[model samples]
Target: MNNKIKSFLKSFTLFEIFLITIGITLVTTFSIVFGANPLAICSSVIGIIGVVFIAKGSVIGSVLGIIMSIFYIIVSYINGLYGEVVLYVLVIIPMNILSIIQWFKNVSQDKVTIKVQKTAKKDLIILAIATIIAIPIVYIILKFFNTQSLILSTFSIIISTVGTYLNVKRDKLTFIVFILHNLVVISLWIVTIINIQNLSLIPIIVNSSVNLFSNMYGVINWTKMQKKQNQKGSY
Candidate 1:
């Protein structure tokens, strides 16, 4: 047991990478038949786990985080969660790149510990104000476009403000911000599924387009990020 612990302490671990990859792959493949709920669950679980694991200083965890990033964004996009989708495409994608760079630097330090910086009170206030701004944006979008239900639509806006802030800023606030936003999103999903209908092929296809993209992004980026990390570590 001592030797095992020592080995674990001295070496880099990829178990999380493999696990998250397998999960996302399964969730991606499964979304076709099981509908969007299961797919979104995969994304959510990946994100929550990724947040905790990354903070614990796992490179694989960071890789998994990128996967979650892509997964949620895509899921949001597909479910007519337009505002959230936009945040994914814009904020989340850029944040993924930053996370990769940050994690890579840590690996070079010959240590496995990750640092979660503190977030400022001012920043939290800014985030709250952003949410207030999102209200009008949500209102305008819903009014102009025939999007999904009001709850889901509004929730999408709220996530965009909070999630974007968390992804861009690496601090203790990230966890709390993610937790609160995810709860709201989960609530929105539960409400949505309560009235889910068996729609025709066309509707399903259009609805699932964003989800498919989300899975695709997570799988592809995770693979690329892991490969890059591995190569860097070897040198």
Candidate 2:
């Protein structure tokens, strides 16, 4: 029985873990020249640390991801990547909070409650109406989604607020959602690299390594946290 446990525990050791993390941070630090503001670089470092240690679906990663996401999305928005901006803007805070709620209690192995279904038709219809209102209101309530930052913020808020109207919950479709989200993220990464013509291969390689290992590093953390949770059940 404990043999299985021992193998799991052996996956990490002090030196191997420390060495890998330092490498990631140092690489990310080098990425500073690639349009990352100081705030973003710092957030990336912190976010990496947070995610690597916390489980992907865990509360810690969620909160940290949410906080860092705002800045990242803002940067994207300013660059006129409006599509991703609209999608991410709505969930920066909520996704993080949901992550916290999903993992807050660990004893419920019989049921998991992470993913919720897509909004109901009525709710989607309301959301659609809100989106419609958003365009014209985007001009009035804000300044123009293009003209003023302050006005743009209002549109962001409007979009964020309406989605809050629902409370219907469902068990997470973890098996499907997890794989899908991962694949999509990987695709996004590929697209990012391809579109970024300014980056030399060396920088791209470094960035890739930083991102990959940091996430792997994050899983180590998630495992540690899970183990801690498991151990806490004992005296």
**Of the candidates shown, which would achieve the greatest TM-score relative to the real structure?**
1
> Which digits, one per residue and each the tens of the lDDT, describe model 1 over residues 1-235?
9997987755533644444455445445545555546556666556544543554445655577568767667665666656666656666666666766775664433355443344588977887887788787876776566555665556655664565455445444454455455555545555555546422112223223333333334334334444554565632
The 10 consecutive residues of candidate 1 with the worst lDDT sum are 198-207
Top lDDT hit: 1
TM-score of 2: 0.46
Give, for candidate 2, the lowest lDDT window spanning 10 residues: 167-176
Cα lDDT listed for each candidate: 0.53, 0.46
Clashing pairs in 1: 74-214
Q: Which sections of candidate 1 miss by over 4 Å? A: 1-49, 55-59, 69-75, 104-110, 198-235
In candidate 2, what are the lDDT values of residues 179-217, reduced to their tens digit?
A: 233333334434544665433222333433444555444
The superposed Cα distance between candidate 1 and the true structure at residue 191, in angstroms, equals: 2.0
What residue runs in model 2 are displaced by over 4 Å at the alpha carbon? 1-16, 23-26, 32-35, 56-58, 107-235
